[model samples]
Each structure stands twice: as C-alpha cells, then as structure tokens.
Target: MHISRQQTESAERGPRARTRKLMLETATRLMQSGVTPSVSEVAEAAEVSRATAYRYFPSQAALVHAVVDEALGPILDWKADVPDARARVGDLIKTAMPRIDEFEATFKAALKLSLDQWAQRQAGTLGSEPQFTRGHRVELLRDAIAPLTGTVPNDARERLVQALSLVFGIEVLVVLKDIWGLTSERAQSVAEWAAAALVDATIREAGNGA
Candidate 1:
C-alpha cells in the first residue's frame, strides 16, 4: 500500500501538534498562577521532559509569546462587518477592551517579558533568547481601518492605525487606570472616544491633503 503525502504529513503533525498543545496549556496554567515560569518549570509541571519542552519552546520568551497569543486568540479572531470606518473601529474597541481587561494579568506578564528582553538586549546580555515581537495591535488596527481604503490616503490610514494602537492594549489600561486614576469603565470610554476622534481626524486630514 502506498502512503500519500497528505497522509504522511498529517501523521507527522499529530504528535507534534499534541506536544505543542500540551506545552502551551501547561505554560498558560503556570502563568495564570501569578508567576512567569521558565520553560523547564512548565515542563516539570506538565510532567514532560525538559528535552521535549525545549524542543517546543527554546526560551522563556518563546513560551511566553505562545501563551500571550493563546490568551489573545479571541481578540485576534474578532471581525466587524460594518461598512463605516468609525463604526468598524468602534466595534473593534468595544470587543477588544473587555477582553484585555479580562486578561489583564496575562498581558501584563507578556509586557514585562517584552520589557525585560529589551533591557537585556540593551545591556548586550540577551544571549540567544527570541525577542517577543508585538504586532497584534497593528494587524487589528489595520483591520479596523480597512473600510477607509479608498477614502483615506494610504499614508493617512497608516497614521490612523499607528495612533489607534496607543489606546488599544494594556498600555491604555496602565495609563488610564494607574497613572490617571480612572475607573475601568471610564478608561474604556476614553479609549473609545480617542479611537473615534483619531479616525475622524485622519479622514479630515486626508481630505485636506495633509
């Protein structure tokens, strides 16, 4: 009997997929307990060998990235079918802000990892750790502004995306709740207002050729 390529690939992927899922779930559980656990720690907790764990996550950063991605799965998959740019952006904010609040601790841990890696890199001590790249907000913002493709200049749309990012994630939570002493409800309201204002401003500027 001849084995097809699809069958071979699927067979190969089965164990790898299960292993990756196990590691991710183990890491998430550990992180939820209020500490950024190392890969070895997660492996130990998950009852998987260190060698197997390292194969899936080469570093703590890589492991945290996967956990954060899993935590953000819902927002990353959100979509708005409205035609108005402002409405689309508002829908995104409304959908995302609550999830961010719900997963505040996870996001904070991820942010800490990002900052720690940054500091290590600046000190030339970052060794072989994979950098925790952050671009989910960029993609989300782009989708939020997709309705303005023809109306707003590409450059202006880019600017709008950039501006909206500032008010989108945990940073907004920190700024509004921690620094400004706003309640969660108030902070979310402000973020939504700022997002809508930025969208309107970008459209106006684009029309004015600015």
Candidate 2:
C-alpha cells in the first residue's frame, strides 16, 4: 500500500491543526466570557500544557488576535452583492452588526487590549510585545465603498469611509447598549439606520458640492 506524499503531509498536519484549533476555541470561549486570558491561562482552561499553548500562541496579543479572527469569521470576508454604493454599505452593515453584537465581549476585550498597548507605548514600556494592531475596517470599509470611487469626489469617498467606520464595530455596542440600554435587536436596527443615513448624507453633501 502506497501512502502518497500528500497523504503523509496531511497526516503530519492533522495534529498540528487540531492543536491550533483547540487552543483557538479555548481562547475564543474565554474572551467571549469577558476574560482576556493569557496563553498559560488558556492552557489551563483548555487542559493543555503551558508549553503547548505557548507553541500555538506566543503572546497574549497573539491569542487575542486569534480570538478576534474567529469572532469575525464571516464578517471579515463580507462583500457587497449590490451595485449601488448606498445599498452595498447598508448590506454590509446589516451583515456585520449582528455578529459584532453576538461576539460583543470578544470585541470589547480586543478593544481594551488595543487601548492598553497604546498606553503602554506612550509610557515607553511597550517593550517587544507584539502590538495588537487593528485597522481591518480601513480596507473592509473602503472596499464596501469601491463603487463610489469616481462617482463621488475623492474626499467625499474618504469621508463616507470614515463616517461609516464610526458605525461599524464595538463602538456601536458601547453606545447602543452601555449608554442607551438598548437590546441587541434594537442596537442592530439603530446601527443599520445610522449606516444608511451616513451613506445617504455623504452622497447628498457631495452632490451639493459641499
């Protein structure tokens, strides 16, 4: 019986993939529960050795980043199906807001880590820790507004992107839930409305040559 090289490679990769998945799932659960656990802590919770967890995630930032990717799974790949820029932006908001609400805790933890890194950098103690960078929205939002590139003024396109960013993420949760005490459904409706309104207002402002 001949086991092909591909088969051999797949067999070798199987355990590594499973280990990585297990660690990631554990970390996601931890962050979802509102605990920004370190790798070693995740190992304990996952019943894996510290050495194993460290091998998978070298630092807390890495672990948190993994959790974020998992939380943002489908949203990260979102694309507009419609041709209309307004409709596309609206569609993107409708698609992403629910996941943002579902993984609310995970995103909150990621935001806190981002803030912590900024403060640490300012205090000159950031050291060699890998920065928990976050600007995916820049690309995602820009892509969502791709249809508006030449139709709207360049600055207006950018202004729409910037304005849309304000309605897209954890900040929505903070405003609608923490501040306004709205439930997730209501929060989502408000986000959807705000996103549509922003797109409409930006286009109208551009049309008026403002």
Candidate 3:
C-alpha cells in the first residue's frame, strides 16, 4: 500500500485543517457570547491541548482575526462588477447587511476588544499584544468606488468613500437598530439609501466642478 506524495500530504493536512476549523468555531461561539477569548482559553473550550492551539494561532490577535474572518464568511470576496459606483456600493451594502443579523454578536464582541486595547494603549499599560487593527472597510469602500473615476472627481473620491463608510458595517446596526429601534430590514434600506445618496452627491459635485 504505497501512497503518492500528494495523497500523503492531503492525509496530514486533513487533520490539521479540521483542528483549525474546530478552534475557529469554538472561538466564534465565545465571541458571539460577548467574550474575546485568548488562544489558551479557546483551546480549553475546544478541548484541544494548549500546545496544539498555539501551533495553530500564535497569539490572541491571530485567533481573533480568524474568528472574525469566519464570521465574515463570503464578504471578504466581494467585488465590484458594475461600472457605476452607485450600484456597486448599494449591492455591497445589501450583501453585507443580511449578514449583520447573523453575525451581530461577533461584530460587537470584536468592537469591545478593540476599545479595550485602545484604552490600554492610551493609558500606557498595554503589554506586548500586537495592536488589533481593523479597517477592512477602507479598502472595500475604495474598491466599491473604483468606478467613480468618471462620475466622481478625484479630489472628492476619497471623501465620498469616507462618507459612505460611515453608513456601512455593524455601525449601521448599532445606530439604526440599537439606537433608533429600526428593524434589520429597515436598517438595510437606510444603508442602501445613504450609499446611493452619497454617490449621487459626489456626481453632482463633480458636475459642478466641470
């Protein structure tokens, strides 16, 4: 019974992939419950040895990033398919808004951890933990508005993206749903409308300049 090299590698990778997935799922559950767990804590929860978990995630930052990525699921692969920035931005928001209901808890937990780290850094008590930087929307928004080269002036492009960013992501839910008591559907509608309005405003500003 001789196994090819590719087959041998697959057999070994199978177990490692499953173990990493289990750890991610366990960490996601803890995060959804409003706890930003460390690597060792997740290992304990997943019933894996600390050494094995460390082999997968070297630090808490790595563990949190993976958990958030899992929560994001398909969102990280979104691409703009239309030449119209307005349509692309609207589509992106609608696509992401649906996931808000499913991953709201995880998003909030991540936000809490970010705040904790920020405070620690401000007070100069932060340890060696690498900063958990989060700004995925910056790049996504830039991609979403890439088609605005003609519709939006270059000077106004970044500002438009920044304005639209304010209305994207979990912050939309935190404002419209949590504060204003809007349903998820209503919140999504608001986001889409806001995005369209920004694009329109940018176009108008460009026209005025031209």
lDDT of 2 by residue, 145-202 (tens): 8887776898888888898888888998999899999999898888888888888888
Clashes found in each candidate (C-alpha, N, C closer than 3 A): 0, 0, 0
Q: Where is model 1 more than 4 Å wrong at Cα?
A: 1-19
* Model 3 pairs whose backbones collide: none
**What is the C-alpha lDDT profile of model 1 across 66-127, one tens digit per residue?**
78877876687788888888999899888888888877777887888888889999999999
Of 2 and 3, the candidate ahead on lDDT is 3
Comparing 2 and 3 by TM-score, which wins? Answer: 3
Using TM-score as the measure, the top candidate is 3
Off by over 4 Å in 3: 1-13
In terms of TM-score, how similar is model 1 to the real structure? 0.87
Those runs of model 2 whose alpha carbons end farther than 4 Å from true positions after fitting are 1-13
TM-score of each: 0.87, 0.89, 0.90
Ten contiguous residues with the weakest lDDT in model 1: 2-11
